[model samples]
Target chain A: MREITYREALREALFEEMRRDDRVFLMGEEVGHYDGAYKVSQGLLAEFGERRVIDTPIAEAGFAGIGIGAAMTGLRPIVEFMSWNFSFVAFDQIISNASKTYSMSGGKIKVPIVFRGPNGAAAQVAAQHSHTVEAFYAHIPGLWVANPSTPRDAKGLLKAAIRMDDPVVFLEGETLYNLKGEVPDASEDEIIPFGKARIAREGKDCTLIAWGAPFHTALAVADRLAKEAGIECDVIDPRTLRPIDETAILESVAKTNRCVIVHETWPYGGPGAEMVDLIQREAFDYLDAPVLRVGSLDVPMPYAKNLESLVLPTPERIETAIRRVTYREER
Target chain B: MSEVKVERWLDDYREMLLIRRFEEESARAYAQGKIGGFLHLYIGQESIAVAAATTIEKGDLVFQTYRDHGTALALGMTPEAAMAELFGKDTGCSRGLGGSMHYFDVENGFYGGWGIVGGHLALAAGAAFRSKYLGEDQVTLCFFGEGATNIGGFHEAMSLAGLWKLPAVFICENNQYAMGTPLSRTSPLSDLSVKAAGYGMVGDRFEGYDVDVVREHLKKAIDRARSGEGPSFLEIETYRFRGHSMSDPGKYRTAEELEERKKKDPILLILGKLRDAGVDEAKIEAIEDEVEERIEAALKHADEAPFPEESLLYETVTVEKF
Candidate 1:
């Protein structure tokens, strides 16, 4: 198995899926000749040709909804948004049509489409551009949301998402693009199903569940606390957020009796709140203390370096939250 | 499909009667609070659907905007199933999920009766694209109003269809006003079909009230499409039979103007032709009675049909593995 970056893996996943299925194509602002604004679609024009890798005009709502129509008629299209913030322009298409097509048609239509790109903050890319929308998308019932942190998970999960008969919002953290990981060379027929969480690290003192870019922050903090503070926190990456790995989460919570959820979104209505609520109901009696959450501050993310750093969840913030949840005061 | 035979005149009358009676019954049902949500009647535009449908084959697909009862009735979506749907019954097509304005009947080649303006244009083009991809000799006809011609989706759909050389036809029913706004205010070029020419498409415009003209234009376009020629844009210039969707004042155009158009009414014209062609009184009476029987049976079926099971609200929110 060779090492690859998260963004590269995402590109490979798209190429492989398109290579395998002629019906799969790409439609977005710069998905064609410009090779994607983020370079994720680099060198794809030569591989798939222009017909499959379409460079659409900046008409987000029009093209996005058209993509939905195309998907219904047997084209599996992957639509790229420059950033998740721009998805608001195409929000009607994704929420009203793409997500609800199958259900509204009473399961008569299957929209095998993916609306994916760097979701969450794109570092230094302030207020208007820096936004995390997993909570907003996950709240919609028909859509499946997947936020993968590692290169391997990005590829595996993306391939799985493309093959799904439902619409998917595959989120990539702008900050985790360069993170390297081993992508297993699976057989041509391998299919990784949804709702399965991967154990990033094993421990017993407490359980820490994190996802997207913040999962790496949680990992860094977990290792630090284990070595210096004698806190062996088990780190779990709940890859697909919608159909969560409830079993693994509750089992870990039941064993450790403590849980700390970390996410990059603001604390109010962040995706972590749902996890905290769910874990409390399932593993409430087993808990030694209330669940602690590490999230960005509940304020619009500022543009300035210091203010931005203060608002975001960092490794230190996660480590502190874990200490609070585990009742090990950092004295 | 080749040209429609003269015998299909009876079939056209039957369909025209169904659309008229269905809309009339729908208005009564709405007043009685039996049907909820938006309802658009095709009272004045009966001939538009009947005339256009003569050119469509079983393999070709059709899509329409919110005012769709006439098209559905013409295409053989049994009024029983359609009426049951308007009542939100389980037996309705789409299982009561799509009421009145949102009818979806795949079996009858009806993609849907969408509420969103200009939404079906691209879907129809996509259907045409699929037919081409599958190497099928069929076409897709999308029906939208003059108001949507300037919308971005209209341009995008027309551009894509033209660029791809897809076998599709766009019917722009220029029915004067878009809800409350006049077509003059909504579009600079009130002639919406010619807008297709900018995208390298051939457009034909005509009076939608004349069934023969509408039938002639639709037949030529469908024939061109099936013979591997590209899409054609047909602008059927027309007027709404009623105030747009039962909620408008009759002040958009004067009664004199409405009377002038009514004088050229295709349904009346067809009946006149039947009489002139020696169709006797007994045959005409028999056709009318047959339509009445079918309508009464449909109304009975709708009334007898139960409301959709309440549990359906909690279902179909998420797609499942087959």
Candidate 2:
């Protein structure tokens, strides 16, 4: 198996999807000639031409809505939000129109549209560009929220998302793009459906559930915790946020009797709340101690590196959460 | 200069009658607590829909605002389905799921009766962009009222539609008021057509009541768009005969102003033209009778239509069950 970057896997998925379906095309602010703001769509315009690799004129709301409308009329469109923080301008279309079309049309129309882009904070982009919205979009009933932590999952889940009959919000993390991982060649029978979480690392002492960038932070702390205290942490990446991998979470919690959820969104009303609530309900019998969630501080993400460090979930915060869950006595 | 024959004029007259009678029906129903939710009507300014639909190319896409009965009727959506949609019946265009303003018939390329004021304008532009991208010789005709001109997406969409040279025709049914807020109260320029030039797109205002004027300019814009020219924004100045919806009291605009607009009533003018064009009195009567019969059948279809079950509401929102 050859190794590929997160960006390359996404590109491969788009290329394959576009080639497979004549109706599938790519549209975004810089998806065509500029090779994308992140270069995920690099070299796409050269091969597919302007027809498939489209360059939009900085109109996010327009392009996104068009993608929904087009998807309704039998064309599959993959629209990039540049950075998902920019999705604010197009949120109405995604929430009101794209998500509602199928049910509103009584199944006569299906919006097979994919709104993809890098999500969550990327270093010090500040408040407007740093907020994570997986929690917000996941709260809605009519969308499939998929965020891939590996190149393999990105490729497989993206292909699955493109071919799916509903609207999927495919959020890619900035920190994971350059992270290399082996990808199995795509096959007809091989597909990763939504709501299926992946166990990145299997362990026994404490269950660590996270997604996107924070998953890496949790892994780093897990390694440290394992080496120092002989405490094994089972790392679970909830591939899809809405359906979450509740089964995986419950099973891990049942075995370990300890749960630590990590995320970059604000701790108050973030995705952590649902995880905390669910574990408290379904996995309460399995709990040895209270489930702790390590997340961004309940305030706007700051610009300064020091302040930013204080705001977001870090290895230290994750380690603390795990230690708390495990009753390590060190905390 | 009204050159439309009696037969064609009668056709549009019937359409106007349908719009009026349907609103009257909706108003009565809403008063009796049958039709629930926001029910915007198109009682007076129907000539805009009829004119624009008749003016554009055969395969052109029509996108409209929440006040969309006229737009649907113009696109030849049967009055029965339109009426039943108001009644929230399973036989409606959207099967009672999209009650009132959220009408959609994608097969006919009727993009919406979108509830969001400025939101669908961009969607229509994107459709037009795709049309040009795929080498399809078609235009996306977006219809919004004057109220939408202030929205953020409207500015962005108009600008993009201009810069990309996309084949989109922006039709603004400027009916003097945005809900309760009059044009004079909201817009400083008051003429939104002039705002099109700011976006580097051509914009013009027209007398919406004069169907001939609307048709002539619409054909010109449609031709310009289909032939690879950029988009054009039409500020079709018309008047809404009813309140914003079925329940409006008609208190915002004066009766004198309403009387003045009545002088420009397109359906009556079309009937007058049909008489002057040497059309037979018997043929005119026959066409009116046919429209009446069609409306009657449509209402009958609606009355007998069923409501969608609650179990059906949970389905189709997403591909997989949570």
Candidate 3:
């Protein structure tokens, strides 16, 4: 095992997958020559050359649809959106063309493409640049939505997303790129399967479920609750949102008898709402308290530093939900 | 007349007539409540599809808009499969999932029956990108209506196709109206091919009334693409005799205008050419009789075909369910 940055881990996945399969190519703005907006595609252009590591104009819809078309004809394209916020421009292509092509063509078309980029708020990028698009993409049927929270998950899940014979929306945390964590050696080739939740920290008193940037916050809050109030929490990170590890969440809720979901997406009609519904419906009898959720405020992300910080789910906000679900008094 | 000329003329005539008969039967099926959803007929514009079929090779790919039955048939999709798809049956090209707007037959290199006007253009470019990337000599033919030329997807796809030098031929079948909005009202220029200059691509415009003329133009574009000369924008001027869909009465145009346009019907134009080529009257009648029988068989097959099993509903959503 080697400690590596999440960005490095993702790059390794691309490098490995591209080497393994010639059909796999990386195409996006600044991916080549500029080495990617976030540098996740650094060194790829030099190693893979211009043909494999392509750079395109700032046309998301064009490249996205092109990626879908390429996938349909037998090339695995990794289309990078500089940020998930920009995917809206290509929403019709991703939703209508990529997602439905398989079923619409009666399984004759397979869009083995990966649309990946930094997702959710990064610094004070504000409304237009900051969008947590997992809920919107996950709601679609023919897509696999993977939001990896750790370096290991980043490398493994990305490898799996690239290899899968379906369209995948790979959401990387904007702030988590530089976060260091242990990743399996290259020879090991660890590929994490989707629809499996990782129990970051296990306990029985309460369950705190989160993903992406919010997963790190949940871990910190869980540590704090255990140290200060002895309120042990089972921290769970659902890396994939679409096929979602319902069993893991239900079993954790059944054991803990309480649940609290935290995420950077908006509260209204978010993946958190879906999780709440799933928990209440499947593990209703086991619950000692109603499953609560701590999500970003339902308003558009604000530009001001203070308001922006308050808009996203913070550690304090997550802890409050945890305490409420476990019936612990706020400190 | 040379045998080759007669053979090509006869093949073109039969193909166009087959499409016409298929579309007419589809309209009847829709009226009888056998085919649900929208049914877009390719009546007056058979020359473009027939020309496309004549130009491309086996590996060449064809993409089309919602009004795709003609292109599907021209690309070798059996009438039974196309009719069954419209009828929403298991025997359909897309196994009853795609319906009228999504008749897909990948085996024939017919990529789709895309419903979105301009959305499939990018995908078409992408397919061409794959060909160029792999050094494969396959050309991609993207057929879209004039309405699609105005959308963001159209510009984006065109820009990429030009920038990448992809082997794609963007065929804009400007059949006057985009679902009843005439090109005069929608497009800034009457010659939609002029849009290609903005993207640094070559432009060609021609009347789509004669299959031979349309095929010759299409062949030049497809040959250029195959030779790695990049994409070309072809604005094929044509007309749709039927409404945009089954629901449209085409009340926007006057009876006189419709009648005037009908006089230049592609089928009639080709029929006249066939007669001038000394093709026998009995031979033409036999082809018509054969097309009628095929259309009748397609209708009967579609009528008897079963709806898809409920389990198929969950199957095709994703290739491998997780």
Candidate 4:
């Protein structure tokens, strides 16, 4: 196994996929000559040439529609928004066209395209720049939504998203792009299918369910609880939100008799709310206490560092919620 | 007259008549509540679709707005499929998943009848881009109301098409009103073709009531695009005789104006041209009879067709239905 940054892992996936499939091309703002805003597509243009690594204008709706059209006409396009926040400009294209084309065309057409970009708070970037809209996208029927937390999952899930014969919204954590982790030295064809959860840490006292960058907070809280508070917990990371890994979460919850779902998205009408509903329905009888959730404060992320920190979920908050769910009193 | 000219003229006349009759029947069906949802009849603008479809090659693609029954009928979609789609039956072109506002048939190169006013322009540009990117000799034509020209997507899509040299033609049907708002009040420029210069593309305007005139203009534009000369914009002047949708009373214009436009009705205009060309009146009557029966059979088939199974509702919603 080799340790690489999540950004590097994503770049490798794009490079490998483009090499393997000529139909696959990366198109968006700064993807070609500029090598991407965050350089996730660095060296792609030079390696794949300008034709394959395209640079599009700053028209989100236009380019998003172009990606959908290209997908309809037998080319696989990876349309990159500068950030998930910018995707709102193209929401009509994503929701009305990309997500509905398959059914609208009587199953004769498939929009095999991926709309990917950095999502959530990248660091003090403020209100307009920070958004975790995976749940909003997953709410649509014809789309596949995935949010990968680690470098390995990023590469694997991205490869899978590109290969699937459907439209996919690939939400990458901006903060986790630079974070380093051990990735398996596997073949390029290897992929982690959607609707599967990875157990980040195994224990029995309680289960902490999370995804994307927030999974790190869950892992940290679980580690601290075990070492300092004598509480062991299982941390589950649901990589895909649409076809969610409910069985894994329910199994973990049933075994632990406790649950605390953590996410960086808004608490109201967010992914956590849907997860809570599902858990209560399927794993209701096994619960020892009411399932709790640790989510960001329901406000737009502020520009100031302190305010942004307060808006996002913290490990301490996750630990506190976990303790409450586990019925353990703090020292 | 050349044999080919007579044959082409007859084909265009038949197409225009079929669209006119199909729309008339659709109106009747909607009145009877056989068809549901918003129904936009392409009653007056039959020539534009007939001419465009006649000019475009088999491999050429078409993207249209919600008033798309005429366009789909002109593009060789079976009358049965179109009627079935309007009836929301399983045998429809979109298998009942898409009704009038969302008619689609990818295999026929008919992309969709998009509901949003101006949204499909970018999608059409992208389709053209794919054609160019893959070195395919395919041209894409996007048909939208003149009101759509005011939207940001129209500008973005047009600019991208020009900048990329995509093989596309954007046709704006300036049919007097966009759901009751006059074209004059909708955009600043009266001649919508002038907006094409902003995107650095060739611009042209046409009288949409005459099938021959529309076919000549559209043929020239399609040829230019097919030759890799980039996209073109055409603003066709026309009028919608009926209300915007099925429910519209169409009180925006006076009766005199409607009568004046009807004098140049596309189907009557072409039928007169056929008679002047010495095409037999008996042949014309026979064609009309055949078209009437086709429409009748299509309606009957759609009426008898079953609705989609309950499982199909969930099946077509996503690709991974299995």
* TM-score values for chain B across all models: 0.94, 0.94, 0.99, 0.98
TM-score of 2: 0.94
TM-score per candidate, chains pooled: 0.91, 0.94, 0.99, 0.99
Full ranking by lDDT: 3, 4, 2, 1
- Per-residue lDDT tens digits for candidate 3, residues A100-139, read 9999988788999999999999989888988899889999
Q: In terms of docking quality, how is candidate 2 classified?
A: medium
Model 4: how far residue A127 lies from native, Å: 0.8
Task: Give residue A116's lDDT in candidate 3 (0 to 100).
Answer: 98
Give candidate 4's iRMS in Å, 1 decimal: 1.4
Instruction: Give the C-alpha lDDT of model 1.
Output: 0.82
| Shift in Å, residue A282, candidate 4 | 0.8
Model 1 has a DockQ score of: 0.43
Candidate 1 deviant stretches above 4 angstroms:
A186-189, A299-301, B1-5, B223-229, B246-261, B310-315
Listed in order, the DockQ scores are 0.43, 0.56, 0.92, 0.73
**Alpha-carbon lDDT, every model:** 0.82, 0.83, 0.93, 0.89
CA lDDT, candidate 3, residue A128: 93
Better of 2 and 3 by lDDT: 3
- Each model's backbone clash number: 1, 1, 0, 0
Poorly placed runs, candidate 3 (over 4 Å): none
Pairs clashing in candidate 4? none
True contacts kept of each: 0.37, 0.59, 0.91, 0.69
TM-score, structure 4 vs. true? 0.99
TM-score of chain A of each: 0.97, 0.97, 0.99, 0.98
Stretches of model 4 off by over 4 angstroms after superposition: A186-188
